[model samples]
Target: MINPLAQFALLLDADLMAAALQQHLPECQAGDWQVTGCEIQHPRYKTYRLAENRDRSFLSLVYHLRGRHPAETTAEQRILYARAYLGQRSQQAYTEAQANGETAIHLAELGMVGWRFPDDPAMPWLAELMDSRQIAELEQRPISTIEIVNYRPEIRCTARYRFAASETEPARVVYGKTYADERGRAVYTNLLTLQRQSVAAFVMPEALAYDAGHHTLWLEGLQGHMLTELDFTVGVAEKIPALAHALAAFHQVTPPPLLVITSQQQLKEWLKKADKLSHAYPTIQPALTGLFNELRQDCPEFEVLGLIHGDFHIDQLLVLADGRLALFDYDELAIGDPLQDLANFAADLYNYPYPVAVIDQLVQTLFTAYSAANHNQTDAQRFVWHLRGQLLTRAYRCFIQQKSAAPQRVADFIALALRPWPLAD
Candidate 1:
């Protein structure tokens, strides 16, 4: 049976969208351009993008998020697009957007909604959060441009711009992570709280604020850049100590806000992922099964020593000013065998476009520095066990992503998984 939501999404068909453009925007009609993609999969509104045939330039169609009509919080089922908050939630913000035509167009009630591209047309409720004196200073140095770098209604909305920030007051990045329903706003709210509390030891983008009503999070943009993009041929090994030192410092915090995952259930969950991967990709079945069987025999019961970055890799580290390294994305931060992080970091070396031997040395250097900073000797046995687990888990994930697992790649993971323990001298 055809799903109702799927049917609704089809309403904004390419032909229909082309017709709408012809009627409303003569300059942007299908006569000169074509509908190349339709991204309005959301049930609340329809959206599409037009591509000019002459130049291949694309123009985005705006979708007004306003619900069918205003509803009391009692009728949560029908509440839409931050509409329920017209009076009770953010009255001042609604008034501002309605006056500015960014939103809240009252054509005798719920009529038309859409953000004009290259304009402040969405999430007018941001004004409510920015009414403070500190934010009022923005009048002097206002944002000159707004560019949507990424957009997915249910996931997040990201924009970068000429943030004319001054030495005194800096501009903050705006973010909003959405959910199936607005009631699930606690996810980002809790994350912002965690970000605010973890600033002492970790280098991360600071969380400025989270407005539950608007489902937005303001973050202080870091001055540094992502390490993944850095060409670190010479200084790559040198930064291991900084990375290890920063990670060790972050773990030292008393009662850090994250879950501990040293339990057997966690290991079982990993095994299941491996089992599923082997079943899904029959090509790696024999090698993956052999590796899992060995892991089942070698798996150990370990205790948590400190916090571990569940997804420790070059991609998660940001190289800051003065050669300092800061970690990004705390959603995976957890308390586990610290070696879980070490091994994950080691296993991820395969991802880099570098010589395997060079990164192997770098991983050794990283673990050595980690031990030195930690002031505690690592149990080589446990380290080896986690190393194999991470390598196999990562291999499974690659398969899940449909990355072509050449015989060499599968062999590499299996070889690492079946390699000699304690990483012999």
Candidate 2:
């Protein structure tokens, strides 16, 4: 009679263990050895030695039957029992994947499944499938069903599943890929149509333009809850009021869960090393260095530190079909002085006509909305201080953009930041 525990240890290899268990345990079926849990106690070759449990702990040893001899037990029986004991492990992995917004593709179900990509590469098989020709083939066909949709470029092309039907009308599916420029610098963008609905509802639908040279993609899909009907030209003066309204609404909403920056200090620290603007604006080095030194001294005091849309500007706001402004791009939402957001709006006003008036209106609208929501003015002075910092920071950003080889909106920003403030006059 083999020791049950010793025999169970040999069944770590799925194939070998399954065969042994099936043979020794006549009651066990092919799928009976479902892996309940597994842990790497030690890595021996390609396998991890694991502690396993079965449904019952009472059956520690074999019992005699019919007075002939004790029921013959083998190493395989022990392995099956161990596998069944570890059944809960897979569920834990599944739960983790869901929490991380990963798309869970059921292998048994051939249809497309949805999943969010996790930062870890623990699933090598899944990684392999993401870059395979199978995905390329799926891309060529009309979008029908999708197994996974990863928004971030780091996890692009990471998906699994079979196409629903060759003849089925493909759903508008957007896929993104990031590549370094000729100089080996990275550029990231959403694939075409992937973010169209979100952009349309929040940002300007008309502003969505594709640059084949830059490889920017915009996909059209599900529109968000907020709807708008206003239409205006890009960089038009007429759009400022609507734009401000949309931005104000965005500022009114609570921040999303994923925003990691909670304070002005934390925001500054993250920006200190982002370095994306370093190549374009060498002036940022001194400005940022000075900002860091004065951060504590210059940091504004605020009564209310509600969620702020970090990059609120004319370009970031959208006029939807219902005549209401919709704010999009929550990538930088965080807890901060609302004035910081207003400052960004003020910084963008110079790009179009009615610079001072537009800036003032936007500020007023944002403040009014914020004040109504929170009913506090404890740090009004502090808000103004932060606003000044934001203006200075915007100026630095403009200076950097101007220094870029092919500055797109730098001149506009510079003009906005340099405009004489109404209070100054």
Which is the leading candidate under TM-score?
Answer: 1
Which stretches of candidate 1 lie above 4 Å from their native place?
A: 1-141, 145-153, 157-162, 165-200, 404-411, 421-425
TM-score of each: 0.61, 0.38
Task: Evaluate residue 135 in candidate 2 and report its C-alpha lDDT on the 0 to 100 scale.
Answer: 48
Put down candidate 1 lDDT per residue, 259-337, tens digits, no spaces. 7786465568767766665544567778777777776776675576676667778877777786667665554666677
* Backbone-clash count (model 2): 30
Per-residue lDDT of model 2, residues 1-425, tens digit only: 22222333443344453344334432333333322222111111111112242222111111111111134332221111111112244355455556765544221111111122322222323343344365457357633433443322222222323333456554343432221221111111221222332422244322233334423223333333322122223233455545544444555554444343444664464354323334334544454445444545645443456567677765555444454564544335566656667666654554444445655665555555454544543244454445545554654444322222223344333333334444332
Q: Could you tell me how far off, in angstroms, the CA of residue 170 lies in candidate 2 after the best superposition? A: 7.7
lDDT agreement with native, every candidate: 0.54, 0.39
The alpha-carbon deviation from the true structure for residue 278 of candidate 1, after best TM-score superposition, in angstroms, is 1.9
